[model samples]
Target: MRLVQVAQHADDLERAAAFYSALLGSEPTAVFDPPGLLFFDLGGVRLLLDRNAPTAVHYLYVDDLAAAIERIGDRAEVIGPPHRIFTHEDSTLGPAGHDEWQAFVRDSEGNTVGLVSFRAVA
Candidate 1:
């Protein structure tokens, strides 16, 4: 089965919206203020930001880890700097002969988010 939706805690919807919009490079798909819900379309999966939801750590794939971090400058607190995590020797988990890089940042609503990217071995 494929994944559908993931919810994360947000104390302020508007602040969360601005932070997410910049990091995702797109506006939210939908927003409801009365019940306090914000939605962003992540490759067909729904990313819901709710006032009552528990915080969750979600890892997002980026084309360029450094570029993504730069784009998110000052908006998010860089908890973990960019660094290589692993190398794929086979095509099972990731592309062969590529290194997996990851970085972590804290979102506006205080949720830790992981940013990931793969670069060919040099």
Candidate 2:
């Protein structure tokens, strides 16, 4: 099955919206007034921001790793900078001779999010 929605706690709607907007580099696709929730479209899935939402660590793929790190700046907490998590030598773990790069950062609400790229481990 495919993921449809991801929920994250957001006690502060405005703050959460702003932080997510900057972090995601896009505004929410849909916002609910009654429930006071915000939805960020992650292609097929949606990031739901509300009080009853569950806390989750989500990873987003980025084409330009350096630019993404630079854009993040000092807003959220950086758990770690870009690094080669898996290299061609670690092919046994996944496919043969494939490298993966990743970095971790915490959102305003303390949910750890990872930025990843499977293209090149640079």
How would you encode candidate 2's per-residue C-alpha lDDT over 2-118 as one tens digit per residue? 889888888777778878888779998988877778899888798898877778877888876677767767767788888878676555654456577788888777778888876
Residues 9-72 of candidate 1: C-alpha lDDT, one tens digit per residue:
9999999999999899999999998899999999999999999999999999999888888887
Q: After superposition, how far is residue 59 of candidate 1 from its true place, in Å?
A: 0.1
lDDT of 2 at 100: 74
Residue clash pairs of candidate 1: none
TM-scores, all models, native as reference: 0.96, 0.80
- For candidate 2, the clash count comes to 0
Query: Lowest lDDT 10-mer window, candidate 2?
Result: 89-98
Q: Residue 40 lDDT in model 1?
A: 100
Question: CA lDDT, every prediction?
Answer: 0.94, 0.78
